[model samples]
Target: MASSFSDMGDNLDSLICSVCLQIYKEPVALPCGHSFCRVCIEKCWESREEDCVCPNCREVFPQKPKLKKNVAFAYVVENIVNVKKGGAGGTGGTESHCDVCNGEAAKRCVPCEILCCEQHLKPHQQKEHKLVDPGVKMEELRCTQHGKPIQLYCKDDGRLMCLMCMGGQHQDHKVVAVEIAHGELKDVLAAKYPHVSQSMESVASQLQQVQEEEEQTENSSRDAEDRLEEKRRLVCQFVNESVDLMKSEIKKRKMEKLSLLGKQREKLEKHMESLREGKSTMDKAFQELEAVSFLQDSKDLLKRLETMSHFKSMKMTPLPVLDFSKEEKNLDRLITLNKNFLEKIQKGPEEHPEKVDLDQNNLRRLYGRSPSLDPNSAHRHIKISQDLRTATRTCTKSQYPEHPDRFLYDPQVVSCESFSSGCHYWEVDVRSSSCWDIGICLNSMRRIGVESGLGENPESWCLEKHYNKYSAYHNKQKTDLSVPGDPERFGFLLDCEAGELTCFGDSRVLHVFRGNFMDPVKPAIAVYYDDDSVHFVHLVK
Candidate 1:
């Protein structure tokens, strides 16, 4: 009975293998009581691993059973491999077959309508097969879905299409015959190829040239930056040197001013000391005079008898008038010294000579130069009389009432006729009774003369007199007019109760005098000139 069961198992295994149609190296039993090689079973499970069943019976089982390798099957495979090699000339086991040629072991060709072995494939392609040309094949190929060959070429649209496409979406589109389109495009592309190639070559060449130029520009820029840095360093050096020089000059000026101030202070101190000494001497002289008076008044009998009763006339010697002349001289010297010192101080530091040294070449490169500031220099000076004398006559007054002291003049508008004939007459008014003088002067002329006060025409014109009354002051005196006509000029002096007026050419004097006991009032004087006459007026408020 055990033998029968073993035989039954063997038969079942054989059927499973035959059903699989392959020798099982590693057999696996399914949950459905079916058996297969492990690879086949795994492949089946991969499709549906959860449902494993027998293909023949459709019987289902709970679990997949892992089967062991069948060593006997592996031996059978080894023996079959030897037998197949011995029976045929290098043919493998009969188990393998070609699908195209059942047992021929070759692929069948439709063009040749024959089964071709490996050795016959090339010959069949070369000789027996009616092969289609590639171009023809491409032209004859039809759309898979529509089964229509492409016909028309749409050059504007850039596409190939069939008659159906033309009738439908592309009906209104422009198209040409395929053959014609191909020929035209071939000509156009042939013609354009040389130009396109030349253009591409030119573009490449330009790109290389631009790159070289950019490199050169970068190098030049670097060189410029280096030069700029050098120039900046030089400028900084120059500025530092100039600043040091200026500082030294300032120090020198400061020392000079300090020295001047020190000298002025010493002179003032000496003058003060002298004034104190003079005051002490005056006090001593007063004490001596008091002592002499006290001796003369004493009363005693014996003294009176012994004393001579004769009254001797005492001749008094005058104390030297306190020589204020020396003081005055010293005071004058002090004034002059102080004036010089103050003027120097007030003048401040002497300015460095203007030395603009802008290099013309450099300045021209920066901006152009202008042609100004290249003219001759002009020199000017003013002079006035140093002497004071008395006004001999009276004159008129000024018009401007606010500045009672200021004198105004209408500029002497000498007509050409008057100037050529060489004589001009003008007048002035003074506003005082005190002693004052005026003189006429010349400007811009080589020859000059005066007629009135400096000893009556001692080479210039001047008038000096004491006018105590307004009547005597008014009477115009006609002394011999010294016509020193090279540029003979004269003016008038009017002394009023208020002030004095002097009008002479460009010179003027006003508000110079008042009465002896009264303070002098400033005079207002004006000069007006027409073609024929010059009038002088003095106004007092």
Candidate 2:
């Protein structure tokens, strides 16, 4: 029996101290009513890594606790140790004083809300009774206002409620039992888990796609920058090469001027030396000291003078004067070249000569012609410039005679030169207005009626603009052609042998029309309405 009791004591020792798990050694109590060994709890509280807390229940303290020894529990420990050593017997956990009689509590009288010894409990049980957990804080379990336990969870208000509140402020509110509300809320969370995960996955996928597009955009932008840089490098290289060529040409011209001038200088210097020698000999003969010497010198001097008289007259083919004005003019052409180069750049590489086998230089050199308007063929409403390069419309009337070839109804005019079976090209500057007409036509189209216009007649072929749109018209029929540049400049090339008429813009061929050549077609322009104007201009190569 004694051995069994010793084993029971060993097992009971675990209930002594929560910190060291040994018999209570100077046990101290916190305000939370949890006890631990003084030194162990103080050391734990001194730790800076964590908030001060009861070792067993983990109730955090706002400040470090001023530990006070549990005097009653210390006495209980003495009795417990005495009983364990076979000194005296005592009850363990139910150690409490009866509120009714001040004796040891044997049970709790829940009806009276008090603990009682067996002597007092027997009489208190006759009213009503229930046991409660000692670990529960009764003040927290009951409401401070009504002194009742919370029973319902208000769904609408989202708060815990006592039964009294359900009748008062929470009347008719959607509510459920606390346990049921907790269970349903947990179920709702469970139901939404997959949806939340799916939403996360969708967001992640969109982010990935955005990242990919961003990367592609960055790469493409970098490639564009690199290509532009390469083009810039090529431009700089061309500038350097052009400067070298210019220097070479200047040096060559300089050397040529030097050689021609050097020959002229040599001839002048030789002539001057001969004249100086003759003068020196003549002076010596004039100042002679003796007759014999004078006579001999005079004969030589006379022969020299006779030879000087017989010398050829000082003259040769006149050479050109050394000057750089023409070269300066050529250098000034650099500005025009740069302007044309910029125009080409604005048109882009699609129009560059490398795109097609057609040689732009050859076309310009072989077929280019200066164009002028013929006044006799112009309409009465039209005004022609003295230079015959420009034509414009007017609302006022004119007293000019209606010639045989004059356009009576339409403001149209013909050019001086015409082509029947050869190549011809010219460019028109149409920058003054948004609308104009330019084309080629047979010498005889019309002299009256609305059909007399350049594009309205069967003998005429033309390209025209109305606002921003451009189209080709022939025989009163029109076809829309793609516009590759602004309407400021339009170039035309006619290959009569091949029976093709081509339109050009921004240095690129735009359209080609083939037809049989039977008549000499003159370059023409029509500005019959809308205060329109047309110009035939020159481009300095």
Candidate 3:
């Protein structure tokens, strides 16, 4: 019966799974006592959530049955498969049945797939064998290359080697017994892990510190930009306010001067009227024949003379005086302005400094300077006054020596003094000129064709006026200013540090330019049309 049960026949076919077509792996018995491999049934009924039916018996389970291995069936299958494969016996035991002797065996021949007892498994045997021990799981102890038990470990190759392999290819390789190699490797790993861990921790700490420093640097950059922008805002506000105050001052001076002159004219007009009345009276008396009429008119003329004499005692308006240097009120006003400016600087925007009026015509003299025109750089068509204070476009050319700086086409002249630092301002008196260009230009640009035109090249910046229209030019880009402006004067303000050039049309801001400028910017005047004139007002500081 035992032999029949162990036979590889129809009865053993029941152990095979229908799904895998292989011997049942972890066979389980369902509630209906129908058996199936656990993996095979799970895969087949995966779509069913509950109440699964057995594939073999078709018996429904209320809930998908929890599976447990069939221990008795597992034992039976193992014994049957083992016996058919020519193993020891149908029972579970450590001893093996030797194929040659049919007796208890001590070792199994790996390549031959047979068992061998102690006598046949002698040390001098040529066959490969491993000790059989059913009490413990068998570990891989044999080398694949030689089909012999692993006796040594080759450290260089990191592999196990048999006696024959070690003596041949592994002869020079560093090797030791397997037990010693395992123990040494473990000890080395234990010794180096602490140092590696410490190094990793140090690197992590330094990385954290570097990240923190980068954040701080970014914060500092943001703060610096904010502060810089704030400073620029304050500076711009102060400069604009100053221009406004200067404009107000110019208007005030003009009014006061005109008022004083008007008063004197009124007094003189009354005196003239009285004299005319006396002349009329004497003429009438002289016409009325002879000494009788003349004697009669003499009394009336004396009375008129007496009335005119009363006006003579009042002195003429003192030349309508408003000298900045001599006037006590103007000096006091300037002192107050300087004090306010200093206070604004010390206390910042919170000071809210009130605008202080200054001389309009002398605005540049206070904040900057207007240098004299260079006689050598003047155009032949430009006639400089004898005082070198005014320039006019002359019809006939003078026999002036030809200088390299002389204008070739565009009748332009440049200043002798150039400023590279600090704020500078100047006034240009266009004075009803039909066409003109007033600006600051580089000394290096001129004496040829279009280059002589102010703001035609990269080196020049100018405001152009022609035929009752206005336009500003810089780097060859023109901007129309719809503002016709007072045909008399314009102001220019240059802030070298701030890289700003501002043009004012009759005290109102006309155009502004932002850019870096080369050192020594000179004021320039260009006359492009007939009868056009431009002059730089002497800004006496």
Candidate 4:
């Protein structure tokens, strides 16, 4: 039994201080069945404030525990100390002991508030020390600044404060209790973070899309440039083609002009050559005659000379020296050639020739002829009667005739009286009142005769005012006749208000007269003739 106990004691002595690694000089027992030097365990518990656990088995301790010094192990260590003695290793030098209070070794339990040596440590924990669990103590503690428990969370400020802080400086700010704020923030972040990430991804995608679009645009620009180049080339080609075509056309026109002018020059040259040939032939013929004369002998020459003198002495004179036949033929041919050239070069209407012949006998029967007609008359009466050979007529000697407002009477010798064939006419100005009666008489009379006794009355001639009388006379009998009782002949009366002229003799509406009678005192009447004759007459009121 003694040996067995000694062996057990040896095993126990082998376990040393976990902190200083030596045999325990002052040993303390923990509630966990672990042992350490009293000072080392106390220091560990005070500093760490954690559950005490055995270093070897990891068994946890309940609370602060008392520690005890092992005196028997100290005696063993002192006796065994001589064996381990060296100059630096004696019992006094190698010993690890608490320097404070230098009495029996003591340990302080922070929670239990006891000093203990090795033997009393377990009992001190059971009886004297008050135990506190670390987990429960942490739950009861509060922050030093806030009197209430700190529970609420502030996400923006990243702090925990009590309810009192919610109404203080932090009021009106975003805040929640710790649990609720954390939960809501977690949900918000969970929902929005992916969208933010997707937005970033979309930005990258858009950049790539823009890059591709830029490339396409650049390609399109290049294509447009190519098309522009092609268009420019085509335009240049068309311009050059047009220039060539115009050049060719100009050259063709120039050649045509040259050809036409060349033909004209050739014709002129042939004419000149013909003239030269004729002169040369005439000269050669004269030279041949001279040569023939020179060849005759002197006696033959004398006899020829006497014969020539005998021929010259005859009374036969040379006829008028004219080659009319040859000259006429040459002139005719030249004129024909000129006519052809003019026909080729002429561009517009040809002018009318100076005169045209008409059947005068047929025309005279259509229009009434004057009784004093002369075949060899020099003056043609268009609307006035004159001495046919001298173109002179008698009127009143004074400048003012009988009635100043009356129109003058003149015998008009018309080539054709038909309105369709057109005729020649004339007008005169009258300014005397004495001529008004004769004007009215002429206007009222349809036909007038040179012989006063030819009509019904011996003293007065018969005249008609109706047109049928003149038509029947001219168309059927082809001779003028007089009506039975002569009406007062008013000459061709120009009614300015009606724009008409009524004539009595030869009464087929011969003329329609129009006048502007703004000045009735000196009204001007213009007579227009189809045969290109016009005359303005002024009437005195």
Candidate 5:
């Protein structure tokens, strides 16, 4: 019995300190011979200034004893710690296992606050109680304020709630059981999953298409650059060749003129030499008393004089003055043409109007504007409302004072508002009118004659409703349109920056006209039938 007790006393448990409950490090013995870790005992006695005591035995000491290392006890403790480490596998997990089966815990019961193994989890789940994962804390499942299990979900607020929370802040909100809410939301997500996946696939396909288009654009840009370089080289070569031809022509003309002048100079010099020789002969005959020689020389001298006089009287051809007027005019024309060509090149390609397919909602939301009719611009037969928002054609022309700005021939009216740049949108309630022309036109549009009609000249573009038929007209060119139904209102979008005039009805684009809109344009309306009217709608942002 003594041997067995001795062996038991030497076990690993005997090396643990009472205060730390860990294997001793730097073990020290007290006066009562009780052993503990040196640091643990020192910390435990720190509060007891006068009565320091042994933690395990509670043996009293009047004064704190000076601690010294118990070398043999520390050596035993180090050996026991190493043995304990070897017994435990090197696995670093610290989670506790089920005490019943000593196996890994599968689930934890929140209400019972117990961990269960697979064998025990079934019975616990059969009770229909909340079973969380082993890693989930019981505190997390409970409400922070009420300290109760969450039972309800607030549908309005979209959050989980306990029973107490449902009665408190979430009482007014729509509340349902947590399970029901989860299942419903999951079903909704499942139903929408295919559509969402299809949308994602479509977006991915579009991305790939865009990438391929970008690659094609890059290749086209490279080809264009090469073509441009070749054109530049050819132009330079043509210009140099032309300049060389011009220089050659100028040199040929100059040589011909010089050759003609040289021949004329030689003939005059030969006639002058003949005159000098005749004068010398006549002087020598006069010095001699020889009548025969004098007579002969005089006759020759007279003939020479006659020839010289005839020659002096004759007209010489004038030196050819190079006529550069035609060349000058041609060069001026070429310079003008070159300047225009360069200006176009500098401006690059014409800006094609952006084709936009926007519904009524987008049109109103993005570029909505309110423009009232201008009574001053209304024709005599077209009566404007008091508020200047409506225009109606009457049977007899009104006796309104004549104004230069008023339309003289056509029963038309222009809006008070004008736009020169940027985008603007407006709508006209034209359901009351069967035959009407609605569009935009420059302020300088003709005020007299049939040319003053909307869409009949270059200054106007309009969508005309001739009774039941519909057509788009601009600059006297008409295009027949296919309309599905009788539209109540006509929406007009003028994108001046893009130089586009679009008319839409019932969210469908009827027609689009594109041109250079250098000057400001105003909305215009033409009502041909008596009592036919159109109203300018006030758009809301």
Candidate 6:
């Protein structure tokens, strides 16, 4: 009866799943003839993208196969488990069963695809068959083509092969014993992994530090720019306030000096009038009175004459006047020193003295413009002065006949003169205007559309100011400018041959516009707000 139970237990072991090492629950067979629990096989192939392979045999399928439950196998497994639970003496087992008899397997013959007991292992030992502990796949231990035990490892193919395969298809391939190949590969990986892991950690730490430093640098740059802007605002305010204070002081001193001079002049005039009256009395007595009266009048006259003589005898020196020669010298020296320092700062590090001289010559010479505004070209809201040197923005329209060249949409005015060739230079006094555009435009630019505004169309390039901010504009594109000082006088240099138009503020380059000039260009100005005006400054040569 014990022997009968052992045989049944050995048969039951054959039904156990290799993946879970337990009796199959809801067994599903793959196309490779390998069976596993349905849930277990699905989980094993969950991460695969293209094809799934059978875990037991490593056979790849081109596509996912549909799972089919083995109902008969599931029923058999369930019944066997129930019977084993009901029985008093269970079937005991320590290892796999022998292929020949109902006995516990002691050794496995890989090439023969068999598990043997000590009783059945004698034949394999005598024949020198390779024996190993059980629980290995029979297919993996032998070559598939030759059906012989794997004895060699082919280095070129990175696969295991039998002696027959080595002598046939793998005859010229580099080969070694399977044991040697496995030991060497294991040693190589073990030696290299530590260094590679250390390098990766070091690189990761460096990258994190670099990212932190980059953020810090950007923050510092932003802070510096903010500080610079604040300083610029404060400096400009200081200068304007100082100038106003100085003007007030000069007026107060002049009033005090004039008051002293007026008082001294009134006293001198009163003394002269008294002396003239005394002289007239003496003359009337001498000419019209008798001898006695004349003698009495002479005595009084003599007293008066004595008083006049005393006044005449008093030493009279020039009155002390206010003098500013010493103050004026000191002021001139201060101005010269500050001007030199400002020039140096504006030039920056890249510009040299020679470059400054050349730039100055370019700006001052080359047919400088003192061109007057053309009344015919002025906008209705723009008031051109009689001299035509200034154009002003007005709230009311001017009473003038409409002309074809007039600017209808904007408060703009153009010069009477135009230049088609040669270098030209001009200056615009923009001190009175808070928002204005000073530039040159082609003579053919549109005069009736919104785009007719200076710097709004392709035919114009302008240095524009909105309140305190400045920008260079061309064809509706704006480039912001950083002008250091309050520049009331703006200089423009146009080199027709070089195709460049340069704007200057405080003798420093503000912006440059480049273009190919093929048409005559006239000076143009745009003013916004009532009372705003721009004057064409006449620069000397």
Cα distance off (Å), candidate 1, residue 93: 47
lDDT of 3 by residue, 279-383 (tens): 787677668777876786788778877876786686764765555444446547756987998897787653112213323445555575756777788888887
Q: What is the lDDT of residue 341 in candidate 4?
A: 70
Against the hidden reference, what TM-scores do the models get?
Answer: 0.25, 0.33, 0.34, 0.21, 0.39, 0.34
lDDT of 4 at 538: 19
Please list all clashing residue pairs in model 5, or write none if there are none: none
Give the range where candidate 1 is weakest over 10 consecutive residues by summed lDDT.
373-382
1-541 per-residue lDDT for model 5 (tens digits)? 1112123443658677888888788888787878888889988888766789777778888888877556556654554454333322211224757646879887788778988898988877899868865656677777788888888888888887788896687879999998898678766656665565465555555554666677899999999999999998997897788778777888988999999899889878977787787677667766978787677667766876777676666567788886667766866887798899999999897553233456667778888998988877899989998888889989987887867679998999999888876788899998789999999999999899999999999999999999689999999999999988999998998888779988898878899899877477999999999998999898997
Q: Each prediction's Cα lDDT score?
A: 0.39, 0.73, 0.71, 0.41, 0.80, 0.79
TM-score of candidate 2 on Cα atoms, chains taken together: 0.33
Best by lDDT: 5
Worst 10 residues of 5 by lDDT: 84-93
- Over 311-359, each residue of candidate 1 has an lDDT whose tens digit, in order, gives 2222323332323355357557756976998899898865322212323
Ranking by lDDT: 5, 6, 2, 3, 4, 1
Name the candidate, 1 or 5, with the larger TM-score value: 5
- Candidate 1 residues lying further than 4 Å off, grouped into runs, are 1-159, 163-187, 284-541
Question: Which 10 residues in a row give candidate 6 its minimum summed lDDT?
Answer: 85-94
Model 3 poorest 10 in a row by lDDT: 350-359
Off by over 4 Å in 3: 1-365
> Can you list the residue pairs that collide in candidate 3?
none
Clashing pairs in 6: none
Given candidate 3, what's the lDDT at residue 63? Answer: 76
lDDT of 6 at 57: 77
